[model samples]
Target: MSGTLVVGASHAGIQLATALREIGDREPVTVVGAESLAPYQRPPLSKAFLHGSADTASLAFRTPAFYAEREITVLTGERVVDVSPTGATTDRGRHLAFDRLALTVGARVRMLRVPGAGLAGVHHLRDVADATRLRRALTGATSVVVIGGGFIGLEVAAAARALGRPVTVVEAADRLIPRAVAPVVSEFYRQAHERRGTAVRLGAAVTAVTGERGRATGVLLADGGHLPADVVVVGIGIVPRTELAEQLGLSCDRGIVVDRCARTSAPGVVAAGDCTVVGADRLRFESVQHATAQARAGAAALLGREEPVTEVPWFWSDQHDLKLQIAGLSAGHDDIVVRGNPDSERFSVLYYRDGALLAIDAVNATADYLTVRKALATGATIPAEHARRADRRLKEMLVASLDA
Candidate 1:
């Protein structure tokens, strides 16, 4: 008998199984995944993996022996076609009955609908296979045109530039990473890329990918301009893989709606990962921290334990030599404070609302980030005046606040 059956053996799914085992719940746990490779890290796909510095062997989160010792059954390269309350059936006509179910079905990359988007040289980096194919195509490529100035696009551009290839980043929005960072931070990254010889085209839209003989050659812009390219990578965004949840009549909006405990509307079925809209805010987090946090909560809930998930939202991105780390959510922020120096490529942008810290984006400031992350989590307020002082250390201000 299947104790717990998890769909989509991603970070969240694997974390769920791991958490369950750590809690000493010795039950049959089966993890089903479509990818043949055991659960691997997705963040490295854009940076180290795409740059060909890291291999697939290092990408895996757990070794085969580890999973075997944990008594977890991992079924790779199998797709769960249908899931009911009692059991799920795979595409290969295999049906497995489960007492409890966990759906960690992650997100899929949004493909461009433009003309020639399906051409050979056009690519999207979502999984290992996608990165593998794109990395292969980047070999000996002279020019790369990246669509969408999001994290993935910028990372790929950095990787290609590192390989001595010319890169042009096209963003339909007025700035890069508009959905996440502030305009000031956006300009900083733009200049950072430009310093490395990357041409960033803002407020530009790609009408179509121009191809010759079924291979992408260039991109035609909405403004009637054409950029030459041997490779094109699209990092537009992603859509949650909620097909299985929705099929089972589970509530779904932008993603499968789950509570703080990662409990879905359907009984005995919990969900975590990029596929869940969590909490009362209905906010969908696409970061690895959010996925693993929700997975831990879901695992505790499944085990009838009282583990409340109250993790602060955070994310990071690696572009060229910069390591940008963000802590907390920046919503309704009324003021901004800059720490360190942006000119030197080491700084932090602190977002605040009504004297309370909202979020922080620290670049090349690991010490400041560690302090600021704790401050944000504890609702510690730092005077905006002290926060803006480039001369004073951020860590000192936090210590003073706690002492007071």
Candidate 2:
């Protein structure tokens, strides 16, 4: 009986445990997590979960009975205090020995160090408790001020608007979703949110949260501006939870470094999810798609499968009745071709560098998204003109229209 121990028991950790059990039920598997609750999907926390459209039951990844029946032992509310080459020690002071270990500790919300940040009405949604607090705060609050126009913030803003609260989003960057989406796609979301009665303040810096006796009343902007509000939701970004890895002398840069097989340099230790940097290149991802996909790959590797992961990375987000999907990786690119009318807000921007597809950002067009998704993964190159064609189907254009 080979002993496999997984730490963090987050999105990746749980998935890895399940995958291993499915591969060989006889393999002794143990999963540890800091959260008391079972693993659940996170993307919905800011949108459906917060808006009352969905609850915890709908977000749960799997029921408790599934783990019991699968023979996967899950230790919830147990935090790994230290991780070494062979195994880990929990805060309960138990030493868990293992032949293999996986780290799936996710991330935490980055907080502003400005004054009055500890104010009562300020919140950041990173977990269930955080969401619960934010939802409760909005009950008596008339207006909500969101600091940072990133995805997390925007989702919360959408939830707030859905609750009939006047929500104002303030972004330090010039455009919304500056880090994730292209400028064109960013503008589309901006327009979508704005049309829903959300006020957006761009290129604005927050100096501090104005408090009335440790309770948030408003915010002070860098430009001597102030916005009256009772609740302030900060969604700047996230910091990978890598302190445990750092302390254990594991290779960590931006995230835990893992090889193509998701194995850490430390013997008997593996890592996955938003906390890992995999594929020898150390590329980090914070999406559920990445977490689950990488977990499946890592579990197989831990079981000695060691299959090279050739799957193309994919991601999606639902907003305002629009489904936005992305395929392939977008680390560095030199050329981008806009394949449709930008003004109409329906297009796919194919990113190419050195005559190879790097990524595609499709807005409000599922067909375009699907086409580009296939093309990037299959390495099927088409004429730049055909990629930009409005009258022809992308599949037909792929071989015929590109011909000279």
Full-model lDDT for every candidate: 0.90, 0.81
lDDT of 1 at 11: 96
Which pairs clash (backbone N, Cα, C closer than 3 Å) in model 2? none
Instruction: Estimate, for each residue in 122-219, the C-alpha lDDT of model 2 and write its tens digit.
Output: 99999888988898887778889999998788878888887889999999999998877778778878888888899999999999999888899998
lDDT of 1 by residue, 58-124 (tens): 9999999999999999999899999889989998888989999999999999989999999989999
TM-score of each: 0.97, 0.93
